[model samples]
Target: MTDLVIRNATVVTCDPAGTVIADGGVAVRDGRIEQVAASVELEAAAAGARRLVDGKGHILMPGLINTHCHAGDSLFRGLVEDLPLEPWLQTVWKAEGAILNPETCYLGSVLGFAELLLSGVTTVMDMFWYPEETVRAARTVGMRVSTGGIFFDPPGVTGDNLKGRIAAAERFFEMFSDAEDVFPAVLPHGAYTVAPENLKTAKQLAERHGALFSTHAAETRAEQADVTGRYGRSVIRHLDDLGLLDERTLLAHCVHLDDEEIQILARTGATAVHNPVSNLKLASGFARVPEMLAAGVRVTLGTDGAISGNDLDMWMALRLAATLHKAVTGKADAVSTAQALAMMTSAGAEALGAAGRIGSLEAGKLADMILIDVKRPHAVPMFDPVTHLVYSTARSDVRHVFLSGEQVVRDGALTRHAIGQTIEAVERLKPRIAASIA
Candidate 1:
């Protein structure tokens, strides 16, 4: 018997073949996709369904994947404003985020996860401090996450100061490596924040465990010029020299990568996560997605942080990525709707090393999906569902979200757990908001 069934929906698998199963029904059992076919076929295939959801006039697709973010900064959503990366990091954000307690980080992760689930994001690649808090929050919310545990020396550690950070990561891995939905990774902050030697240590430890090593590289022109000035190589090349750029490395915000750097990323099979809203808001450069895609690089989408993006909205990231690619390249045929959908879905899953598990609406994959209200006004004149999702529809239109075949969101409201208390707790934190802003 199927645990739950969704009937009469336009199913977009976003599979490699770009399959769109129109007039389809989904059979889910034990938190996995059992079958996807016409309603009659689904009914016959699963004779007994504990619960069946009528998906008439709805679009069913894989849940969105937000591949990179700072879940530790949710409380500071609007604190860092009207400043570039240097000033924002040097002044407002760094000072604030660097001091977040485990409790604050937990609250922030919970809030961020809630927002992502509301916007149909089933998977997240979160890089932050106090990750045990993030893991606990993920468990509570029942959201899948790739945890990029921070491994950097404190403000001033001169020589070979990696033991403490590495120990922390090892402990994290040991604790949560067997977790059902948590994937632990080693994350060095960025080229500027972390020294070359520390990057090498992080790479070694990450490679030792075949774990994902994430970092912010080549985010701005200043960051770009400084790296090249010091090493006579691009930022990506420098990381490569440290043995950091590999299939196990996830480089976020490769906005200033040159053509050769793009080639290196493609050659190394490393993943790139483009943070368009954060880049735009911070006045950071747009990642060369057209060139990156042309070079066969696997690119995914991310919402950097609520502090930078002003909201934990992956839908905004998807729309910004599609439009930003076109606006910058001045070509209408750039970053196809299908490809954009892939980036937010299967490509992100692949980046997190969970390709066949959650990114696509396929049989045997974990049943993480969302039902879009196709009848909405902005979603009208329904020429192409992909384009509508990318260009027209807002995050508010997410009517339902599912994780592991369970209805986490129903009728545009969270149903898996009680979120009102979390929201209220965040609101109560208003007393401390002044300190962050100050």
Candidate 2:
């Protein structure tokens, strides 16, 4: 018997051919998708399902993949604002240094993951301090997370220095070697905070253990100039020189790249995560997403952090990405609805090196998906499902969420934690967090 079956939904299968089923059904067994067909076809196939869901008036699609974020900073949302990357980082880092511990990190992650689940995000790639605590929080909430055991000089939470950081990552990999939901990576902060030698070491460790390596790059003009002054090259070129640019590398905020730098990213096969909302909120320049996609570069979507994005809402990122590029390039066809959807789904899966897994609703892939209520005021008069999904849908439309065949969200409420208690817990920490900064 199958674990769960969802039937009678508008299934937007983000497959290679972009198939959309009017009345589709998906069966899940052993945490993997068993079948995807019309409801009439799957009725008998999933006749013995342990759980059956009526997905009427819902848009079913793959769970949104958040390619990059600093999830532990959720508690610091709006704490320090209206500043660019440099000053913003300075203040946020201080707040992190003052009160960051395993417990606080867990609380912040729980807060962030809960928000993500409500917004239809199931998988996230987080680069932050105290990642062990973050891992624990994700597990508790049953969210899929690909995060690094991060390190920096004058380390933030995990260790003291680069050496200490590598040791901690090794231990983390060992501890979570068989983890089904958590994928461990080796993440250095960036070229600005970490030396070239440390970046190389981190990449090598990631390669040795077969994990992901990621960091921020070219988020601002000041960052580019600093890297050029220090190394006589841009950050991308410098990382390439250090042998850190590869298929495994995921760069966040490639917002200020020139033509040559964009070519370098394409040639290196590195993935760039476009954070349009965060970039705009921070007054960072626009990323050349249109050019990147045209050059055959794999581009994905990210929400950066709740502090920068004001919320971990992928719908904002998707809608802004789909619409903002048109205004920037003065062409209405700049980033298509299909392209924007791909960036969060199939393209995101490819970027995270999980193309065979959770980004699509294929038969063998993991059953990570969300059901959005489409019989709402904003989503009414639906012409194209993809267009409505990209342009009109809101995060509040998410009705149900599944991770590995298990229902983590049902009817806009979290199944793992009490919403009132979660909010109250964070409210209790408000005084201590504020006093630390004071």
Candidate 3:
């Protein structure tokens, strides 16, 4: 018997074919989709369903995917903004460098996960300091997470620290390896933050365990100039020279790549994650997604984090990604709604290394999806569901969210705890974080 059934859904499957079935129904059993058929067909197929949600006036689609984030930075939202990457990392965001303890990491992850779940992001790729704390927060909040411990060339974290970092990452993986909610990966911070030697070491570590290696690529003009000036090659070319761009690499930002870089990414089967809002806020140029697509590069979307984006809302980022490419290239057909959907869905799943399991509404795929309240004023007169998703919808329209067939959000509210609870947590942390500022 089916455990739950949702009927009367305007099903917008973000599949390759982009099929939209009106008055559709989905049956869930054992954390997988059992059937997707007409409401009457589903009702007749699954007798004695334990629960039924009348998904009237709702658009049911796979949950939005956030391919890159710094969960530990959410608490620092608005703490540093309107600054370049180098200056922001050096000064205003310096508090995190010193003050980010286990408690702060967990608090920030909790806060970040709360915002993400509410905004219809069911899964994320996190690069943060405290991997254990990130797992704790994702487990507590009931969201799917793929995180990697950071590797950088700081005075404190040397080549010797790689051993301990790898150990910690292994411990995290072993502890949560069987848990469906948390998946572990390794993260190399960025091109300028870590030495080339460290990047090589990180690749070896990831290869040993057959894991994904993610890093920040050319996300800003300064980074691009710094890399070229230092290495006499573009950032992507340098990575290619070092054999870093491969099937396992997930490069974040990717704002300043040329046609050669695009070809490298395409040939290497590497994934590029676009953070439009964060890039724009930091005055970073728009990603050449259209060019990248033509080059066959797999592109996905991410919110970056609250520290950079001021919100863990993927909906806003997806919209920005949909429009910014067209606006930047002066081509109306730059990024179509279908391409935007792929960026926010399957492409992100591929980045998170869960491509076959989630990111779509396939029968065998994991039951991860969101129900948008299409009854809203702005959601009315929906000519095309995919178009409405990119051009018209807001985060507030998310009515119900699920991860692995379990409801994490319902009635447009989080299911884990009360808003009052999150507010109290944030309120408490606000004063402490503010007081710690020097």
Candidate 4:
């Protein structure tokens, strides 16, 4: 018998052709999509399905993919505010030093991943101090995560030296080498915080493991100036000079890139992840998203972290991504709705090198999808489902979510884990978190 069947809904395939079925659903067997067809076409399968979900009054689409985030930093939401990237990070690090440990990191990651999973983000590329804890939290919340050891020059949260950091990164690869849900990566904090040789070492580890190398790059003018002063080149150029730009590289926040840098990214096939909410909140300048997209740079989306964004809301990210550039560039269509949506879906999966497994609704792909309720007042009279998702849908509209054919979230609540305990735990630590910077 089929494992599960969901019928009677609007299916937004998010495929290259952008196929949408007006009244259709999907069949899942052995944790993979068996078929995606009209409700009428799925009747025979539904008859013998182990479980059937009637997705009436909903739009089913592929789950969102967050290409960049610090999930554990959710513990510091709204703690250090009204500062730019440089000073802001210093305060943030001070707080992290005081309160972050493996246990707390896991707690905070659970809090953050709960928010992401509840809002239809099935996969996330998160950077945090405790990558094992990050993976633990993702598993507890029943979501996919891409994370590994962190690389920082100074004694950060883990306080590991260069040799210790290398060992930790390699150990991470060994631990999760077979984990289907964990995508291993080596995350150096940024060019400003990590030495050039350390950055190269991190890249080497990633290359050796065939994992991703992610770091903050040119998120602000100060960062660009600092990197250029240190290396005599801008952030992207410095990375290229070190031979670190490639298809496996995930660069967060190319907000201050020049025209030549944009060309370099396109030529190297590195993905640039845009965190609009955090960039705006921290007063970082707008990313040249339109120029990058036009240059054929594979652009993706991220929430950054709740610490900077004040929340992990990919819908807000999606809406801002779809609309923000238009206002900045003085063009009504600077970024199209589909392009913005792709940044969180296909582009994200591509960035993680999991394009064939996730990202869109298709036969033989993992059953990672979400159902958005269109019964809301704002979602009514939807002309285009994609437009509605981009401009109208809210996180609260995500009523059901499936990861690998398992019902991780049902009726807007997590099924694998209860979040009330996590909330209470964070609330207890709120005072300590506030006092860290004080």
**Candidate maximizing lDDT:** 4
Clashes of 2: 0
TM-score of each: 0.95, 0.98, 0.96, 0.99
Clashes of each: 0, 0, 0, 0
Ten residues in sequence with the least summed lDDT for candidate 4: 77-86
Best by TM-score: 4
List all candidate RMSDs to the true structure: 2.2, 1.1, 1.9, 0.7
- CA-lDDT, candidates in order: 0.83, 0.89, 0.82, 0.94
Of the two candidates 2 and 3, the one with more favorable lDDT, higher being better, is 2
TM-score of 3: 0.96
In candidate 1, what are the lDDT values of residues 170-237, reduced to their tens digit?
88888888776876788888877788988888888777777788999899998878888887877888
Please provide, for model 3 over 291-317, each residue's C-alpha lDDT reduced to its tens digit, 9 standing for 90 to 100.
998889999999898888888778888
Ten-residue stretch with the least lDDT total in model 3: 153-162
Predicted candidate 4 versus true structure: per-residue lDDT over 1-438, tens digit per residue: 799999999999998888999999999999999999999999999999999999999999999999999989999988888999889988998999999999999999999999999999999999998799999999999999999989999989998999999999999999997888988999999889999899999999999999999999989999889889988999999999998999999999999998999999999999999999999999998999999999999999999999999999999999999999999999999999889999999889999999999999999999999999999899889889999999999999999999999999999999999899999999999999889988
Native-structure RMSD, model 1: 2.2
Better-scoring candidate (lDDT), 1 or 2: 2
Q: Tell me the TM-score of model 1.
A: 0.95
Model 4 spans > 4 angstroms off: none
| Lowest lDDT 10-residue stretch of candidate 2 | 151-160
**lDDT leaderboard ranking:** 4, 2, 1, 3
Candidate 4: what lDDT?
0.94
| TM-score of candidate 2 to 2 decimals | 0.98
